[model samples]
Target: MAQQLDLVDFIAGLPMPAATAPQLNPLDLLPRRPKAWERLVAHVPAEDVRISVSPTWTRVVVEQLREDGCGDQLLGNGKIRSHDVPPDLIWPEPCRLILMTADSAARIHERWCLEEAPGAGMSSTFRFAQQQHADRTPVSQQLRLLAEEQS
Candidate 1:
């Protein structure tokens, strides 16, 4: 007579399935974009300028500046280009504002120095101007900017 195998013995005899790492989708690796309302915008009273600050780019606009009794005049408007950082690693809104303000002030000071004293060199105090965003700004938006920059 043949010996009967118990249930536990039979189960244990089965081969175990190979353990494989989970496959990641290419799209999952892409950065997410933030909604329009999530974007950060701040007004700088010192410069009478408005800026949309983000981790990937910063937009600066001086609506008007009183220079020698000038009214309703455009002082300057331009974009500050920057590299991207992970949204989770970006600075908070208040910090971003402070940095942006410092950068703007530095630029203005540099210009003034250039005009007043030629050959004078001034460097910005805050180099990570673009790595900050308003508090309300979503992380997804920041990530989106990073992805865009990479592309």
Candidate 2:
């Protein structure tokens, strides 16, 4: 039938599909807006459940903080505060909660915690990540995606 031939012609005229791009991993870039708890959970050290605190995020400054005993905070631009803070601010064992004030400088507003975990250091990246999460910004997750794409 004429209709049958037309159908066959139509099918023949259709182009083949193009090659597909590689599949992207979701974990590569964390979402721009994720739950605050997620970021908190992500930053906390799973093994010890303690977040080290730092007073500043400079090479020389950090060394000083480390020397001063409040130097347990991990890498990043956070100045850990709290002189009488107990351990487990992030995770409470003796419930040594982080003491804080909603204080702000010219360019930054900080919530601080005082801690003496002996030899524990909280990851500042985690703190940065936590702050971002509180603001619902997951921009840091892009690091993973970018690394994957480059690889």
Candidate 3:
């Protein structure tokens, strides 16, 4: 005849709840302010930069990003998730990119950033053609204007 199963062993094998629930971080609730925002605002105010929004892109403040749950993406890789952007943002021409950074004070700063295509400046003809077009202003020119305005 087999012996009866031990009650203590069975109870020990059962899952138990944690003594305390995970504590929420107070800082997480606070508005996220990356250092890049301050530098950008100092270097180029929001008004100075022209944001051409798209369904996948937008110009938003750190607070808005945090509120909209974009802090992780913005803080992690410095790249905003296209699908995460709000549907309300209207897309326009001449999109301006902003890079973010964090400072010692936990403040956020914004700065102008752009991505150039590979071999984009390889040919003078392309540059000349760009220069010939007066109707459309180049990104470099717009960036120069931002610098000039700050000075």
Candidate 4:
């Protein structure tokens, strides 16, 4: 009987629980809304791809593409707009959007890895070997050749 009373006393000494604060919608705490570009950056179409590379290799990659005759397909850096892509070209598995910064590239790497579509990407770092060769050609001659090619 004494042990039972001790248990009852212990139970009686415990405080009753209080209610939690009322739930608030998470959106209520937002400081501001996102801009249109900010929203757009979070998503990219599967058909389009992003290539994140250092500026040094970026030039090399662009030059390589130009030599390969895909220069017109290279749109200056931005999300791939429908008008920007060439209608004549058909992308294989994982075609990349051009010229993503290192930071943007990391985010894209993460997103693509999660999707298990690694082939759908390219990084200029992979092409750094192109820069290793010593070119004996003069800058002026290179420029002249580039101009001739453009014409």
Please report the candidate that would top lDDT against the real structure.
4
Position 64, candidate 1: lDDT = 23
In model 4, the runs with Cα more than 4 Å from the true position are: 1-52, 55-96, 114-151
**Residues 1-151, candidate 2, lDDT per residue (tens digit)?**
4545588788999998998866433222222212432443354332223222234323322211122223233222344333433443433332111221112110121122112234444222222222211432232242233234333
User: Against the unseen true structure, what C-alpha lDDT does each candidate score?
Assistant: 0.29, 0.29, 0.31, 0.33
- List the candidates' TM-scores in order: 0.22, 0.17, 0.20, 0.24
Best by the TM-score measure: 4
Candidates 1 and 4, the one with greater lDDT: 4
Poorest 10 consecutive residues by lDDT, candidate 3: 120-129
Q: Lowest-scoring 10 consecutive residues by lDDT in candidate 1?
A: 114-123
Model 1's alpha-carbon lDDT is 0.29
* Candidate 3 lDDT over residue span 46-68, tens digit each: 32232221222222432222224
Model 2 worst lDDT run, 10 consecutive residues: 100-109
Pairs of colliding residues, candidate 1? none
* Alpha-carbon RMSD, candidate 4: 16.5
lDDT of 3 at 76: 47
lDDT per residue as tens, model 1, 25-127 = 3222111223221132222122222222223333242322222222222222432223433344322122222213333333333322111111111211221
Model 1 per-residue lDDT at 53: 23
TM-score of 2: 0.17
